[model samples]
Target: MDTHEAAGCAEGASRRSVLAAGALGAGALGMGALGIGALGGCAANDAGPAPAAGAAVGGHAPGDAPGRGRVLGPADAIPVGGGQVFVAEQVVVTRPAADTYHAFTAVCTHAGCLVANVSNGTINCACHGSSFDATTGGVVNPPAPAPLREVTVTVTDGQLVLA
Candidate 1:
């Protein structure tokens, strides 16, 4: 009810609005570029990064870059069609194929929300209703509006490893 408190709240709200507007504008531009075949013609990653060389996420190799990822186990530890979630670090490791293991940052790309649920081959963020397909790393539902960051995983001998 005081003038100082009201002013502070107003300032906070304004800052948030500005930030959101900037993000929206950038998204519109990116989408436009993709529509014209200027970009986004490759794999689908809602809010995932463009994969830096040697960047490992939860023991997975990224973008076909030759490097070691995080060690999960002796190769067979992560069974086909199975995955594991690291609560402390907020990352998930899923093996959709016997020789392929995908690790995605448990953090939702949208607003950096932590993904809280993974069911029926989907990762769901509790902060919003953004559901992402664990297998394909694509956005399955909205509210997330972004793609999960892919963590490149490589199996070395038998240990699941990341860079």
Candidate 2:
């Protein structure tokens, strides 16, 4: 090719590279911001006194009570051999046996993302695929490093309340 044509192509390629680098830098910055935000949220969550169970905390599900010591509906809300996630309270309640229930923090100990689902006697965190035992809240998968924090629960008059 002619010199001018080759020079023009080189300039265009350089521009593309510069644009790609700018985009990459912006993406990195965004990811860094996200990491910071996640950590900040974790800190805020840790700073508080667990929101007093029923207080109208941020990210609470609709229809949740708005007072201290949250009332998690009926005791039967958590089916036998299954569990329920109370996102507002950041707690998970599981029933491993008849007339018995276990409660633990839903926050994943690894990265602070709430545990997503529970199945087959395990509370699963979708963020990094960590799993904890539904009955004991013990870590059942890697990357968790610790068991979920146990939350005291009591069933009173057919209603479940955080104790």
Candidate 3:
């Protein structure tokens, strides 16, 4: 073959290799991003302590109060001085004192993990050992940089509903 033709072929091969390398690099970056997102949602540093014995775990019951927003369950399901985690709804309802209730998002501020349970006057996240005050939703421990976000709740006909 002519030298010019050989040189052209060599250049084409070099371009193809460069393009392939770029594609592989892009794929790796995409996979890394996906892995980080999955970890944020799924990683729990430890399951942490099991819910304190007989701690409240609220669930919806039939004929609960029908309202303008989501029904969390009967208000009585939340133990006084403790709370219940509504995992599917991403909420926590606490009855810190009789006849009073508070609510907050279950998502942890540290890494987007869900808060696992409530006990000892604090809401707890298993992912990073962060805790928040059950009554005020204030941060009580770290690795968490912020408190859980408060969610408004109301009791209607003895059922707790999102407000």
Candidate 4:
């Protein structure tokens, strides 16, 4: 082949190589960005303890009475030996005895997911499969390293009130 033609072929091959390298670099960067995004989502899920145990779970502290102490519902909404999760209030109220009741924050200590359900005397968190005792808020299953935060509650005028 002519020298000019050979030089042209070499130049075209070099251009193709450079473009391929650039595309590979861009693909690697995109994958790295995706990995970072996934990690960021996980980190957000594990941010911190939901709310303090002693107070209302969302935004009210224990003594933020005027703002936080809304009547949850009738005391009987919680069955004897079982509990009810109030997602709005972020509290779980359990009646372990005939006239006794207990309240705890619904936030899971492991990954900050709300405790989803109460069954068979246990409060279950769906996110990471953590279980807590309905009566005492103690951890029953692991992935959660701590007990749920306890909240003081009282029955007033047949309604459950956060204290």
Candidate 5:
């Protein structure tokens, strides 16, 4: 080829390479922006009322009430190594031992629906079959990726009260 034509062809190839690099850079930037948005969305939230053990399907914390809550005593109310659903307060209080108790929301974190059942040591949300560990409130399964909301529980005079 002629020297002039060869130089022109090299310039065209260089220009195309720069454009391709720019496109890749733009795509990477877009992905990074999306990742940032997702991180912000999941940043800690203190945005709402605390859920309770027996509040309802959608449990709310004792703080939601103007007056303090009425605590219920143990004394065989909760079966040993079993849980009791307080539908009124939307709380599930379980007694793993005579002195050890665990409390979490009765509602499924996925859809805000009442957990259908607690069986085999896991709380089951039938709405989507999402399961939360009854004692720890950890997600045992997906579809409901977030762990079940936990409540601060206090035992006063054998009565379990949300603190």
Candidate 6:
């Protein structure tokens, strides 16, 4: 109603707008910093070329390098037409036939639980009754949206090693 009161109100509104702008600017700066930090983590490394998105490389994602060349056990431990679950290493190794071996992450695709065992020609997960094909790691039961992730493995000197 009065000029002084109106001026005071206008000043207050201007101050609020300035404060809001400052907060927005700070938020933008923080997001930029976070983006730069993420890109910095993707700098070149000695792990060789990166794999495609969602691709499984030895049970690891791109830029994730671990357990390389680590021996799981004697190749003979994996029986024909069945597999062995290495719980500690989080890998399920299968021998579809005597001279062939395949490896997959024991971690279930639906949930993060580790697979319990391999039986009846399938890799069994006790957590949710999910099972994957022993030879191909394909899903054989529900609750698992995807197949078990394939992990590269090699036979060296009678030992099964992660490649």
Candidate with the greatest TM-score versus the true structure? 3
TM-score of each: 0.51, 0.63, 0.65, 0.62, 0.55, 0.60
The C-alpha lDDT values of all candidates are 0.54, 0.64, 0.63, 0.64, 0.55, 0.63
Better of 1 and 6 by lDDT: 6
Supply the global lDDT for candidate 2: 0.64
lDDT of 5 by residue, 129-158 (tens): 678787898999867768776766787877
Candidate 6 to truth, TM: 0.60
lDDT (tens digit, per residue) of candidate 3 on 1-163: 5331232211112334334554666676844543322222232223322222122222322112223388878999898988898765667788878899988877666655557788999998765578999988889999878877787889999989988
Give the C-alpha lDDT of model 5: 0.55
| Clash count of each predicted structure | 26, 1, 0, 0, 14, 0
Tell me how far the alpha carbon of residue 122 in candidate 3 is from the true structure, in angstroms, after superposition.
0.3
Decoy 1 TM-score against native: 0.51
Q: Which lDDT value does model 6 have at 103? A: 86
Write the residue-wise lDDT of candidate 6 on 55-87 in tens digits: 553456532325878998899988888888775
lDDT of 4 at 48: 28
**For model 5, what is the error of residue 53's alpha carbon versus the real structure, in angstroms, after optimal superposition?**
18
Tens-place lDDT per residue, model 1, 1-163, is 5321232211112334334554666676744533321211111223222222233433443222233344545657666776766544446677777777787777665544346656678877654467889787789998666677787766777776765
Candidate 1 deviant stretches above 4 angstroms: 1-70, 73-75
**Candidate 4, 30-127: lDDT as tens digits:** 44543322221011123323333333434554323232578899998888888887766767788988899988877777755567778898988765
